[model samples]
Target: MEQNLPVACVDLFCGAGGLTHGLLKKGIQVKAGVDVDPACRFAYEANNGGAVFLDRDVESLTAEDLASYFPRGSYSLLAGCAPCQPFSTYAKGKDTTQDAKWKLLRSFGDLVRKVQPDLVTMENVPQLPKHAIFNEFLEAFDGYHTWFEVVECKDYGIPQRRRRLVFLASKLGAISLIPPTHEKHISVADVIRDLPEIKAGETYPNDPLHASASLTEINLKRIRQSNPGGSWQDWDEDLIAECHRRDSGKSFRSVYGRMRWEDVAPTMTTLCYGFGNGRFGHPEQDRAISLREAALFQTFPKTYQFIPKNERANFTVIGRLIGNAVPVRLGEVIAMSIADHLKMVNKAEKKAN
Candidate 1:
């Protein structure tokens, strides 16, 4: 197993490093990382191999810079996940392409085409059954042996009902994603039940990583009316916002909702902290889900500590990173799949020789 290990990996758009953490867990060396988001510097480095983080955007990654991150002359594996917000169908009517973020994947592909690593991988939201960008990407890789699959997170033992599209390609030899583990599903309670109770806006006394976000008084009232596994429809007519009474407003019922302890959480967005966004309320608690709970729902290990002695636990910062991250568990699946593929390639070459 030690002999099969790849020398190094460079994570582009590393974010807070749910992917980096997964890479490290499989004994893959993450040499250097890059991301535009400054919020990631502390936690990405804190948890994943203490890598050097370049705060530059992925578009700026040079072939030479990527070359330096790998071993002198060995198998080169390059991994990057471009920002996914623009392609998301949720913002369909909202002019997603108007934003500069949509061009990031093409920029990432530029680097991929230049560096031409032995292996490449990327993950993104399932751009609804629409969108030509995904098809364009496939045509771009016309000559390469590529495999793209829309993997449901539960099939790979993530427990959460997340559906993501993952792509893997190789020049070293034919490689495929790791077959799903599909052992058993982890429940909402399985991940967060052990955490100590913190009222809305309360932090854990002993472990700062366990700290929850505080609730404003109005937000607290909103949570009280929300039911676990229930939507804004549960709110009395008096509590309903004036717009909610209208047809257009009724469509927003998924907001200000509580999670079912027995079921998995809805996909966590970057703004999971807001009570009015997504089904994020805490079960049996009168507040939106805590930062720690959100992290757990994202499949971060309960014992996964972010800050050390010198740092203060800021929920706003951690929450954003955790919420925005590729779930560490999801990363593990990708990493292991890459490792397994490389192993198969090596064994095949040995047999042919």
Candidate 2:
């Protein structure tokens, strides 16, 4: 019945269309995606069922700009995951209150008040609930019922140990995320075991995005000694970096480590393409996981295209895009939650009438 109703959505800060793609898969009609990065335009528009990509900053987006994307009498859903770097656990001890990125949530709240959409959703780091801005964002939903919680992506069948804060608000009575879909957690091998192998720095001719970053001799040696789920401690004393030898650096154990085949992957970050960035190295191969592997770990489809055919793949650019995206599976969970909420609301209305 949600399909019979024109349930249109406008995705804000829609990087590479991850959320839009997932919503589309779950039967939501995404009319447009607004993001400041022009680099995301091609992937966003190309993969998201021809949804228009608006290259505009969320700070500059007005109610009029977003409302135009939804059809008259349609159920309008506004969704976004504001850039999370400022609030990430990695940003510990840094002063982010003064950061301009801090105010983007305020802008999102402002638009919600102006547009008064039928539904709203947001995804962010688990730490966001601790900030004042999060409370400010909630003020935008005075008349709407809201539910938010930190969710484990692995419980939702995502093959990564990513924990994110998911928020839902609706003018339609009550709302919450749907129940977890997986009892047995998905594992690393379960997702990427079938992809053909490529050595470090080697690109599979058939898929440029499957390329891995080249490792220096010492780093390669370190990776070779690294055991699955083991850290730098497994390396020879001679192979240990000077920083890791010191007392302060010993606490940073996950760097230059390998993921276990049977367990979920560690959280993917912007620098996850590098062997030394967290436990990103392959369990059996003597190299970091390729870009394609990282994307698959993020629950992106195997055929998900990141760059145009003419353009050479830049690991940093594509890595950031993939790392920062709302995992496609998590996005589907969010969309399903909304679908269930709509169904309940529709049933109630019918019974009352």
Which predicted model would earn the best TM-score? 2
Those runs of model 2 whose alpha carbons end farther than 4 Å from true positions after fitting are 1-4, 88-99
RMSD of candidate 1 to the truth, in angstroms, is 2.8
Instruction: Provide the TM-score for each candidate, comma-separated.
Output: 0.90, 0.96
TM-score of 2: 0.96
Model 2, position 13, has a per-residue lDDT of 91
Task: For model 2, give the 10-residue run with minimal summed lDDT.
Answer: 84-93
Cα lDDT tens digits, model 1, 216-280, are 77667778888888887887777777888999898887888888888877887777766777887
lDDT of 1 at 162: 82
Best by lDDT: 2
lDDT per residue for candidate 2 within 141-247, as digits (tens), equals: 99999999999989999899899999999998899999999999999999888888989999888888898999999998999999999999999999999999999
